[model samples]
Target: MTTRYIDAGVNLTSSQFDDARDDIVMRAKQAGVDNMLLIGTNTQDSMHCLQLARHYGFVCTSGIHPHDAKSTQADYIAQLKTLFLHPEVVAVGECGLDFNRNFSPRSEQISVLSQQLELAEQNNLPVYLHERDAFDAMRAQLEQVKVHGVLHCFTGDKHALDFYLHYGLMIGITGWVCDERRGAQLQQLVPLIPDDRLLIETDAPYLLPRTLKPKPKSRRNEPAFVEAIVREVARLRGQSCEHVAKISHANFQRLFITRRGTQ
Candidate 1:
């Protein structure tokens, strides 16, 4: 069987990322993932992501993770602009708000998110947003910009899901969906996500699924593990994994790879 997979959210800067390319890609092949969208949590991470993508011929995104929001500055945007110049850097963020941690002050989060949104707008780059326990604040921030991307690693309930649906934003689901305890809700809820608006990811170096057989020694996640997410989503939706793959592949193409080189 032929598999065309997109590991939509992964960390190329992780220690695991230093594993040789052939080893990394081989493991991904084991999980049936052929394509990857590596996440860059900062300017440095994003550069490494783009460079690795070029080397591996994998798709990638320039991710400015919400955790770094406090330190985000004008120079950050300048650095991001340079990263976006690479065709492999398909999106402008992993950027958004996370009230759950409150690691960064709300003001700093708002300021940085605002600047990143404007950066996405001005550069015409698609966005990859991250939100946790701050749905209302995130929605308010998004209200000011036209979105051209997804709310990645989505874990919200129906209302939050519906709000993004109205905004015409796509979603990227991760291994968190397979958690029998916390993810039980998603088992029912994920199917509600329209086919066109759905996609799958690993969020590697994080969110490892329990179903994984003989877990890694350190238990760090990787792109190869994304198949567990895809399979679990299919089970929840009562559809074949192949069907899920086809639709998500189409969604990825639509969102990141423009048709006929046009938007």
Candidate 2:
């Protein structure tokens, strides 16, 4: 049987996709990735993601990303709530703290993240999180709420991984695992994530797997490349690619689709 996959996160709304969106989705399906969670960083992007999800029969997220936290309007929560009314919007993020760039003030990031967490809890929806150099703040915020979701594109160390796992969030690994040097740590940590909590994403238009041969000249990542990520993850965990693909597909369903009574 052919192995199938679900790319747990994808920025399908990115301008980088431009006119090739249809081809991109087709290529992903041809490569065995049948479903994807389109990430939304703000109200406008969230709506675009939802439209794409509806058109392509995929799920998506609805929340503001930390980088945009500073510009979040006074009624941003209201906007998110409106987006959540659509079942295609499964999780509450692409949202979290990013002290690494600090494009938004630390205070704004915290406040916006806290509000989104509350929205997730109130709606009983899982959160699709992003964190970079802000694990401590992320952990502190998570402690105050009962939210569950994937920490998309996780690159943190064992301590962060342990806390997220214990807190009941799924782990999302990306093409970063395919890099020999920068990915060294992630490769070592891949085996530690439990099967039930493991998810894989492309974070497309970014993080192209360095291991891909005949690399695309544009260097733009896409959902189809999730196959490479799965294979690498399988190798790291000493398991078959089919097993990793199956479990990640199942995990995505459980966290986003199944719980929402959609597939």
Candidate 3:
């Protein structure tokens, strides 16, 4: 039997899909990607993602990204509260820290992340976290709050992976795992994630899998390519693609759906 997939993260609101959104989603479905979680990086984008989710019967997340942390207004949490009322908004982020670029000041990123964590705890929503070269600070903030979510597109070291797992986060793997060079560490670490705590994503329009054969003419990633990540993860873990798919799908459903079954 063929394994079906659920994309844990997709930036379907990206301008790259401007005239091709419908086709992109259709292709994803044809490729066995039956569901996806649209990611919203800011309030306006979150609204756009929510609209798309409603239109397509997909789930979505709403929050300020670390890159946009400085732009977080005092009323940002209020804005998120409104977004959360919609049934399609399943998580509280795309929010976390990125010291690599530090587009936003470190202080601002922490402040915005803390507020989002508060929103998650208050509303009983899981978070969709992001961290880039800022794990120390991110871990500090996480320790202060009780929030649960996937660490989306994780490409960190074993230490970071263990920390998140110990903290009870489901790990999200992407095409980065398919990169022979940059993904070397991830390849070695794939088996470390237990079956029940692993999730898969494309982070579409980005992180195109380097292992994709007969690659598309354009470099833009999409939900359909998520299968490649699943395949690689399965290969590294010495499991069947079917097993990985089922486990990841179950993990996704449990984290984003079952936990909120009461809502």
Which residue runs of candidate 1 sit more than 4 Å off their true CA positions?
19-22, 259-263
Best by lDDT: 2
Candidate 3 global lDDT: 0.93
Question: lDDT for every model?
Answer: 0.83, 0.94, 0.93
By lDDT rank, best first, the candidates go 2, 3, 1
TM-score of 3: 0.98
Which ranges in model 2 have alpha carbons more than 4 Å from their true place?
A: none
Model 2, 189-250: lDDT tens digits are 99999999999999998999998887998889999989888889999999999999999999
Error of 1 at 39 (Å): 0.6
Model 3: how far residue 59 lies from native, Å? 0.4
lDDT of 1 by residue, 1-263 (tens): 87667787787668765765567678887767767787777888888888888988876777567788776656888898888777788887878898999888988888888888898887777888999999999999989988679899999989999999999899999999989999887777898998999989888888998877878886888888777888899999898888888888889888887721463
Model 1 TM-score is 0.94
Give the lDDT of residue 94 in candidate 2: 90
Query: Residue 28, candidate 1: how far off, in angstroms?
Result: 0.7
